[model samples]
Target: MEIIILIAVGMLASLCGAIAGLGGGFIMVPILALMYVIPVSDISGTSMAVLFVSAISSTIAYAGQKRIDYRSGLTFAVAMIPGSILGAWTTGVIENRVFFVSLGIFLVLMAISINFKPKKSRDGFLKPNVSRSLLDASGQRHEYSFNMTFAAVVAFFVGFLSSLFGIGGGSVMVPTMILFLAFPPHIATATSMFSILLSAFVGTVSHAVLGHVMWDKFIWLAIGALAGGQIGARVASKIPAIAVVRVLSVCLLIAAVRLMFKG
Candidate 1:
């Protein structure tokens, strides 16, 4: 049955999303469209709703791991809220082809950035103004820095991307954090999920208000995504930090290609 398929897809997508901090909306949107679950106009709305549920589940698990950067997450969340609402309002009005292509280009660039580290921090790479030192559940210590002004600016747009693409913006946020903000993969993934939870909530509500969410379908997806999220957080915790970035880079490239074609 379609419900069964939805559950399966939600679980698989959420598992991948949680591991990569993508939040699964991008994966779900394309498939849901193919299934004719709803009109394309409403697809993003539905995806955002499901994404919020998945994020909630994953954020809780990541929190337990003590991997999330709460200060950075809150700063990003505050900036992203407005963009989430605005993106929902403009969803059906934008040109899908152009947006998709632009996002694809951006992802490709991020992937390249990840594969090739700058020769040195002085090689014209961004350096953060504020520093943080965190000890995760594993008792491994991580020290990182970020520019608050820059992160706020990026998060505002990240909120728009989350709602606009229904991808939770983690596809973009994780790489930015790791590459630019000096966040370790574990911390980046966890922090990205935390920020995404807040953005997804705003985006979901905006879409629901516009009557874009299909509650009947959302229920099944939620059930599956919820379980998958917990599993993914566990899996990610076991992977080495370098491996996580490698996996994230691969995922970004994959999502970029699919999104371009979907557009």
Candidate 2:
């Protein structure tokens, strides 16, 4: 029965994470700590294990749909590695209360930012020095530009938070890419998932080394993530860009409120 519950959680996490590019960590970690009585120390690593699997599965699905912007994804992912390493290293040093409270606050801010008067490149407010063009699976063309410096800076922080919280940083990545980088919503979501693979892999290995991983439950979560990720990726391809943002914002708000109380 416990095993069944874990898989169900994994499925829910992967489904929502894939849709929002949040990597389900925002959902999984709080539940594991507050409901399942899992230690906060182990939650991050276990969340990472689930995220790694979902990321890979979703990336494949998105790649086949030609939604992934590999060039941008790779650039951001490379910049995120150092931060990922550092975040994983500090997991042991930070107190559990501090971790949860900080995470709760961060999520609250994120929820407000993304939901209230959302920002996008479509407004024709600003233009950057870089330009990019890509074609998706449906042969739809997307072209945009953004400030490389801003993107790199955002990527660094995203990595840090991702590793620290065992999330894919999609909560940050998706919004930043769309608002600052001028990326199309679908493209951002797919690229975020692709980029998460690298950071999650690093964080997972680091946590495992630090003996924070819950190995007994890893396989079940991973299995559920793989299955749910495929469904999520498929659904994402059909959804409107604005819908994606709204769903993510709601999830963030809910997660933030729940986590604040849990902490």
Candidate 3:
């Protein structure tokens, strides 16, 4: 019964996550804690497996629509790998209460950033000016001119948080890409998901090596998430962009509050 409940929860989380491009770990982790009393040490490992499966499933749907920007995605993925490894390595040593508190703060800030309307870009923002250019996986020359040093620093932080909290880092990565890097929301979502896949995969491996993964539970969760993700991706195309963004922000804010209270 417990396993069944988790699978159901995974399905629901994946559906919302697919539409928002969030990978659903934000939703899954808390619920798992409240209902199953799963240990924090194991949550990241299990969630990473679920995230990996859901991402692959969602990507298949996005691919059909040509919504993925492979170039930007690949570049970000390359940079996130080492960062994720470092993060996973550090997870066991971190205090759980401190981790949750920090994550709460980060999520709240992200929510506020997402809700803010900027006037310069269509999404009401401007990309930061920095100078790093490279060919994306799609063979397009993309430039990242927003203080490479700062971006790397931020990426490292994001990666660390993701490992600590069992999230995919999309909550952090998407906003960073949009507000700081000036990526369009859709492109940012796609790119962030790609980077998350890499980060989650590496993080999971690290956790597994540490004997933190619960394979039986994770497999069932993955199965449900994959199916739900397909449905959510299909629905995403129908939702208005602003509506989606607003809804996503609200959800993130709620989750942040919950995490803070837990802390």
Winning model by TM-score: 1
- Tens digits of per-residue lDDT, candidate 3, 1-263, equal 87788779889878877777788888888877776666777877788778887887777776765556565566666667777777767766777777677777877888788766462453212344344444433455534334444555566666777766677677777777666765555556666666677777887888789777889888889888989888977787567656667766876776687677667
lDDT for residue 254 in candidate 1, whole number 0-100: 81
RMSD of each: 1.8, 2.2, 4.0
Among residues 3 or more apart in sequence or in different chains, the pairs in candidate 1 whose N, CA or C atoms overlap within 3 Å are none
Question: What tens-digit string does per-residue lDDT give for candidate 1 at 71-148?
Answer: 999999999999999999988788888888889889989988886755234211255678888998888998866787
Candidate 3: residue 89 Cα off by (Å) = 1.8
Estimate the TM-score for candidate 1. 0.95
- Total backbone clashes of model 3? 7
- Pairs clashing in candidate 2? none
lDDT pick, better of 2 and 3:
2
Q: After superposition, how far is residue 28 of candidate 1 from its true place, in Å?
A: 0.9
